[model samples]
Target: MKKILIIGIVASGKTTFAKRLSQKFSLPWYELDSIVHHNTATGRYKRSAEEQFEIIKEIDIKGAWIFEGTDRDSYQCLYQMADTIIFLDTPLWKRKVRILTRFIKQKLGIEKCHYKPDIMMLKMMYKWTRDFEQSRNSFDAKLNRYNEKVIRLRDSNNLDVTKGTRLS
Candidate 1:
């Protein structure tokens, strides 16, 4: 798709899938994280809601992009800009394993992670998904009006959000 939006829970592989899609489609890839946040000490984006909105508003105006993120930000501006939404609803256990595994790799210097992992950081990551801090569920009720626009994937290993399930 020319204008695709990739969304999912933290550690659900949304970013990885988005990059793959970009390669497949041969289109420009845009990371919401890059535009919406500043790097923390450990190379993690320091989130700022206002900044995110401003950036998304500008980016949406540009149109024609493949944006990726897990946060269910109700930027009607951003949603209207996207032609399709891909929701990656990976299982909880898999998500945890992905997080822990990445943490271990980063800690061991086997692989570089975008963020640092400490006990508190791990707790935040767990909470991020559980509380829908950066997920589709956060905008479930509000986006109900836009069911026609959504592509909900409640279960992992689904073909498509529309075929898999409807959030509202």
Candidate 2:
């Protein structure tokens, strides 16, 4: 696909999958988290919504790109420009395990995350994973409004980045 949008709850493998897709297709990939969070001498701070919109607009005008994250309201224009959208509908239990594992790794300095890992971040991740089902409905509705091919990968095994064809 020329342009791809990967959306999912935090720690649901969006970044991982997008990276794979980017490598497979030889297209650049952008992690929305990295764009939104700016590291300063003080601490990590988010860019203004207008700034985020401008950044996304620049990416959308590129020849091809794969963007991973969920900020539908802010990146609606990018969503419209995407040729394909892949939704990582991973189960809650798996998401919980991933979130916890990632937190431990980041805390131990074994893994680097876009944002620092802390107790507050961990708690927020847990709550997001627990309430993901409710958020999923809104994602579905948004996807329904777009005509681009949307692939819902419910399990990790279902995604085959090597296969260029869109999943039915």
Candidate 3:
């Protein structure tokens, strides 16, 4: 795929999948969170919706890219721009386990993260996951608009790069 968007909630393996896809396709990958909360000489700050769209546009001009992140209203335009949209629909129980495991790893310094791996952040991760499920209908409806280009994966491990994403 030329332009890809890997979308999912917290701990859904979007980042991992995007990395693999990018490597296989020899494309650049971006974490959308980095765009939303931009780092500067001063500190990290949230960009406005307009600014976020502009950044995405700039990246679009550079050619193929794979962007991974939870769905956000600010960057909804990416859906229309992408050649492929991968939705990681990992199981709820597995995601819950991953959230805890990730927190433990981050807290123990085994895993590096952009933000502090505090209890609050862990709680927020779970909260976001729950919120995502509650609003899945809305998300699915949005996804339907791009049904021709969408691929849903229950687990990233099951994907076979050699066979391509369409293979079961």
Q: Pick the candidate with the highest TM-score.
A: 3
The regions of model 3 sitting more than 4 angstroms off are 161-168
* Cα lDDT, model 2, residue 88: 81
Higher-TM-score candidate among 1 and 3? 3
Ranking by TM-score: 3, 2, 1
- How does residue 108 of candidate 3 score in lDDT? 90
Quote the RMSD, in angstroms, for model 1: 3.9
CA lDDT, candidate 3, residue 148 = 80
Pick the winner on lDDT between candidates 1 and 3. Answer: 3
lDDT of 3 by residue, 83-167 (tens): 8888888899999999999999998999998788998999999999999999999898888888888888888765563333442
Model number with the top lDDT = 3
Q: Once superposed on the true structure, which residue ranges of model 1 sit more than 4 Å away at CA?
A: 40-54, 72-76, 133-138, 154-168
- Candidate 1 lands at a TM-score of 0.74
Candidate 1: Cα lDDT at 76: 46
Please give the TM-score that candidate 2 achieves against the real structure.
0.87
